[model samples]
Target: MSRPALPELSLLMVDDAVKAALLEDFGRAGDITSQATIPTDAKATGVIAARQAGVLAGIDLALSAFRQVDPSLDVSVLAQDGDKLEPGTIVARIYGPARSLLTAERVALNFLSHLSGVASATNAFQRKITHTNATVVCTRKTTPGLRSFEKYAVRCGGGMNHRFGLDDAILIKDNHIAVAGGVIPAIKSARAFAGHLVRIEVEVDTLEQLKDALTAKPDVVMLDNMGPELLKQAVKINKGQAVLEASGNVTLSTIQAIAEAGVDIISTGWITHSAPVLDLGLDIEIG
Candidate 1:
């Protein structure tokens, strides 16, 4: 089945990211190599092609990078984010000043390749547990400045987002539990300050801790590093008291086992932090 459309990323967000990247690349000199080799009036056509098979993402951001560099450039997006791609697929085509195309090439490919990698990795994890009730999720362990973009790519690959940030939800981790003295205390502390609308989740490393956490009646409990057998036990103990989240040591090889254990959500940092970059190249022809 074809994947559903991904939500539109904010234009303002894309523009800001592209502008920052271009500034870092251009600095004061601004594309010295292109300026020296390409004439001011020189024109070129370029095709952004995938060098390997993977899911496509960040087409808009890539186009924005080019437009931000030169508004006069003609850009045609041949594929949208969330589309599955094969090697040699033309993701986008650009025709404009050779200098402008050259200037934007690296930055555009950086966004496209990195976000597509995130989508592809997410898709890999999602595909592993398609028959189960569990859903794949992304964590905050994203690139320092690219959390929003990375999380968006997760959704493009048919995964759900956990929380956008700390303010969106109260996730009481092991550190918080220790600081507050225990799971119940941590839940209580969060409940005291957080509004009633906020859902509280706590991470527990043991079934004993899970039992203790369940008594607090938090909205969700994360089973950290638990094996499938332990996860099944936790699910049985939960008995619909709270949502179960499986995290830690999650990989493409082990994800299916974790999902089969009956957890409602599985979150991993690898998709955003360590995913391999999708190989894409901008092949240009100067005229």
Candidate 2:
């Protein structure tokens, strides 16, 4: 199936993040090495190209990095986010003062490579389950202070996002179940306290717990660490009662089977928290 049009990430959010990253990297003194080496008026042109094949993301943040350093820098985005990329693909071309380009290089590639990695990982998961009536999803386990950016990357790679934070959705986890006394009560408490629009999801480790939690009518149920056989059983028990989300121990190797087990969503942590950064680099043109 074709992916939906990618959603707009707020320019304000992108600006704020780029500004903070620039501040952190530019701390105390600016790029002293660039300042000392490159002539003040010298200009350079370069193409930020992929060093390996992967999906694309975070081009805007990379542009923001360049502009934050030198607004006069001319950048042409040859490829947009969500595009499939290959080694030597020219993602963007830049002509700007040499010093500023060098100064902004790390931060630009940091955003591009990292978010592209997330997108690529999510894409791998998507490809695994393309035949099934299931969607790959990302969880709250994201880089601190960069959740929105990473979640946007998940979208770029055609994955659905789970709750952004605790406030948006009431997820009664195992701990919440323990502290609240039991599965049914925890969901009940959340139901009582939650607004009409709020969705309540509860995590259950056993079939018994899943059956019990369903009684309280949670909006969704996360079947933690269940194998495909158990998941099939759980799906049978669910029988369209509530949305079933299969989570934990998910990897590229295991995702397709999990999807085939009939869970509505497969929530994975590694895609965002641990996906390797795609390799991309700036090749300065000679002449």
Candidate 3:
């Protein structure tokens, strides 16, 4: 499948918000060392280089962080979002005041590293699954304020994104199941309450519940915590009736096995929430 396109203006706007947050993080004072050691009039050039192999993302946000510190800074992108990078690869080049560069360094690195980590994790999961028609997907397991950027990184890493927010889709989870007393009732209430355009997905923990959910004709069915062998059986039972999404306790080691079971989508929380930060750094080029 082709990569999804993100609007340029939306990306820029998100970058602006991230920049504001970074400014709040620093307040009036800047990096004390750069402020003390670097001349106020000092001009410097540098590169934000990756220290390890990983997928690159949040290039725009990093650039915006630097620009917020100093708009006149000349920023050039050597790698775009979704680009896979090797160690020592220069992802971006910046020429500006030494102080602005130093001040923006942490915020920029923070976003870059986190986003790269998400993308890296996502790519590894996507690599699993050989024959079955299953797409790797991400859940709401994202950084609180950075959902858009993190989901964008998921897309960059070749994984599909679930609903960006609760408003975007209706997922009747276990709590909904309890409130309604069963999967069928929950799905029924969701269908009755949801707008005409809204689609309802229901989560089922067992084949019996899956059957009930299928009978109710949900838009999607989430097979919660089902292992690969069981998932294959569920897929057989589904037989294209509704989109099948396998979720819970997913890991890189198990993803390929799960995907081969023929689930339509696999949602893993670890990609965004548990991935370690990809190491990156910005080193000043002395002139």
lDDT per residue as tens, model 3, 1-287: 65567434286666767767786777777577887899999989988999999998888888878888889899999998888899999998899897888888888888889988998988888877646678888889887878888888888887888998899889999988998899988888888899989989999999999999998999999999999899989999998999999998789788888888888999988888998888989998865
Write down the TM-score of every candidate.
Answer: 0.97, 0.98, 0.94
Number of colliding residue pairs in model 3: 0
Q: How many clashing pairs per prediction, in order?
A: 0, 0, 0
- Candidate 2: residue 56 Cα off by (Å): 0.5
Query: Mind giving the per-residue lDDT tens digits that candidate 1 earns over 128-213?
Result: 99999999999999998899999999998889899989899999999988889999999988889889899999999999999999
Off by over 4 Å in 2: none
**lDDT score for residue 90 of model 3:** 92
Candidate 2, residues 1-287, lDDT tens digits: the string is 67589989888999899889888999999899999999999999988999999999999999999998999999999999999999999999999899999899999999999999999999999999999999989999999999999999999998989999979999989888889999998988898999999999999999999999889999899999999999999999999999999999999889989999999999998999999999999989898
Whole-model Cα lDDT of every candidate shown, in order: 0.93, 0.94, 0.86
Which portions of model 3 show Cα errors greater than 4 Å? 1-12
lDDT order, best first, reads: 2, 1, 3
Ranking the candidates on TM-score from highest down gives: 2, 1, 3
